[model samples]
Target: MAETREKLLEIKNLKKHFRIDRKHTLRAVDGISFDIYRGETFGLVGESGCGKSTAGRTILRLYDASDGEVKFHGENVHARKSKKELKSFTRSMQMIFQDPYASLNPRMTVKDIIAEGIDIHGLAKNKKERTERVNSLLKTVGLNTEHGNRYPHEFSGGQRQRIGIARALAVDPDFIVADEPISALDVSIQAQVVNLLKRLQKDHGLTYLFIAHDLSMVKHISDRVGVMYLGNMAEIATSKELYENPMHPYTQALLSAIPLADPEVERTRERIIVEGDVPSPISPPSGCRFRTRCPFATDICAKVVPEFQEYKKEHWVACHLYDERYADQMKQ
Candidate 1:
């Protein structure tokens, strides 16, 4: 089913490095490759500082790429040099930022915030048309038309996020990068936002690159999931496949930490405790970045980097444990 769909975004060997000084260069996103299909939510999961956010930013061309290519609908995103070309791309791709409070302008009214894209894109001709469009968007995101006149400070975190979503939708974009859109909201409100995103995707024929640390929510909303560790992609698989049978040790450890609702299952389940903190990206471990914390790491892990390859039908992993050449030493 996935092979039949159109590829909306293709990221090949993508990397984003930040130079700290003359001596140090931080490898935030290091050569991660993945393709997001049209009309599907591709969830990217990792621990804090694993480069998920940096990868999203680089893909959207918010940050210049240090290496590799990001193609959106066959056109290279990073190749767009002129303001006119970038402005044209902005209409097709949009972003829903993590912090609703920081993302929206404090001085602008909710109506103005939502219609900013519309005005910039010239979607509306007259003032009355702009007002009607803003009011309609407000209603679509579960906010009333009357609320459009109010300031952003008057609304809650969830409402502000809805406004952000409405703003992204105002451009009528085909793809959106939702950078931890619900991480700041209340536990109860998180589900509401997730559901809203799902509904909007269906209504608008939208594709999403949903970035988050929450595995459960990712599984709930995403069709496929990619797990990252220390700036590299550890695994990529269908959400159900990845959660049920995680191949990479980092992915296994992350899924093990998610609390199950069933008491009996929770009590019997074995938790994978990954020891040691994540190494600094400026000077990561030689060969495999996860070797320092991986339980199954052998001498070969320090000497050789495992290639990211398909392990089992559509499930990809980058781990020496699954590499046939190191089978003898990696056997549990």
Candidate 2:
């Protein structure tokens, strides 16, 4: 299915770093590259501080990339452009933030909040059109017209996220960056929001970069999944391929930790316990970032960084254990 579709966004060697001091710099997103295909939900999953959010923001051009190119429909996202060009670019892409509580303006009514994009882009011709558009959006996101007059503080966490979704959809974007959008909601509300996203995608043919730490939900929502470790992409493949046959040690450890529903399978499965805490990104370990805690680490693991390469069709991994070129030395 992904083979025939065009690439919506191509991220090449993308890096986002913050200068902490003269001697140290935090590498939040360090040289990771991937393609998000049209009309597919590409999931980025990792630990809390593994730079998943940073990567998403960089791809969206919300953060200035330190290195690399993000091409959106063959146009370089980070390149200098006129205000009109930038506005057009922004209209084609939108972001659904992680925290709904913090994202929405507490003082503004829901109608005004959702129409901010419409007003900015000049999508509506007049106040009547704007009110109509806002009301329609509220209904589209499962809220009623009456809810539009209320402030963000009046809604539940789930409803607030719906309003966020409505705002993103208000712009009629081709691509959306959903950065852990469901992470802040209640467990029951999470499913509802996820279902809403799926429905919206089908209805609007929306492409999404869904970033989160929840493997179970990611597996459920993603067409393809990329696992990140300490700002490095460890593995990426189709959701089925990644879950059924994860090639990297970090991916293996992550999958093993997901609790199975069946009691027998849960009891029989071997847990791949990753030892030690994740190293600081400010001074990330040299060579392979995962080498410090990788179960298959050898001397070469510390001496050289493993290249991210495809082992099989659509399955990519970065680990010395899977590199055929190092097979001989790994035996020692």
Candidate 3:
């Protein structure tokens, strides 16, 4: 089904680096590539500081890329554009930030906040039209029309997130980068937000790049999932396949950490405990980022960077164990 879907966004070797000093640079996102299909949610999961958020921001052009390209509908996203062109491009893509409290402005009323995009894009003809559009968006996200007159501070975290979602939908964007949209909310509220996003996608025909550290929630929402490690992609597969049969050592370790519901299975299942702390992104390990902690790591793992390639049908992995050249070594 994914093979037939149109490629909405193409990201190639995307990298984002922050200059800490003249001599040192922190590699937030380094050489990751993936394609997102139209009307599907692509979940990105990784430990904190693994560059999941950075990758999403770079793809959206919120932060300038240090290297590589992000193409949206075959047009270069990082290319310089006229003010009008940029505004037009922005209307096609929007972002729902991580923190509901920080993402919204306390100074602006909810109506003004949701209408900001509508006004910028001239989607609404007049004050009456703007009010109607804002009210409609509020109700779409399960918020009451009356809430539009209130400020951000008056609402709970979940309500504020609903407002944020409504704001993203104001321009009727085709693609949205949901940067850990539920991580800040309570577990109970999290389900509501996720359900809202799923329903909105169904209604609006939206595509999503959902970035989160929570693997469980990601599995619940995404069609495909990409696992990131120390700024590089470790694996990419269908959400069900990846969770059931993780290929990369890093991916296996991550799934093992997700606590299951059944107490008997939880107590009896083997856990792949990855020892050692995550290396500094400024100076990651020589070749494979996970080599230092991977139990299956061989000498080639430290000497040569493994290519990210398709190992199984639609399952891509970056690991030396699957390499033919190192196959004998892994066996030994």
Count of clashing pairs, candidate 3: 0
TM-score of each: 0.98, 0.98, 0.98
Give the poorly placed runs of model 1, Cα more than 4 Å off.
Answer: none
Which portions of model 3 miss their true places by more than 4 Å?
none
Question: Candidate 2 residues 1-332, lDDT tens each?
Answer: 63588999999999999899899899999999999999999999999889999999999889999999999999999999899999999999999999999999999999999999999999999999999999999999999999999999999999999999999999999999999999999899999999999999999999999999999999999999999999999999999999999899899999998888899998888899999999999989988998888888888988999999998999999988878889987877
Clashing pairs in 1: none
Best by TM-score: 3
Q: Tell me how many clashing residue pairs each candidate has.
A: 0, 0, 0
Which residue segments of model 2 deviate by more than 4 Å? none
Better of 1 and 3 by TM-score: 3
Lowest summed lDDT window (length 10), candidate 2: 1-10
lDDT tens per residue, model 1, 87-185: 889899999999999999999999999999998989999999999999989989999999998999999999999999999999899999999999999
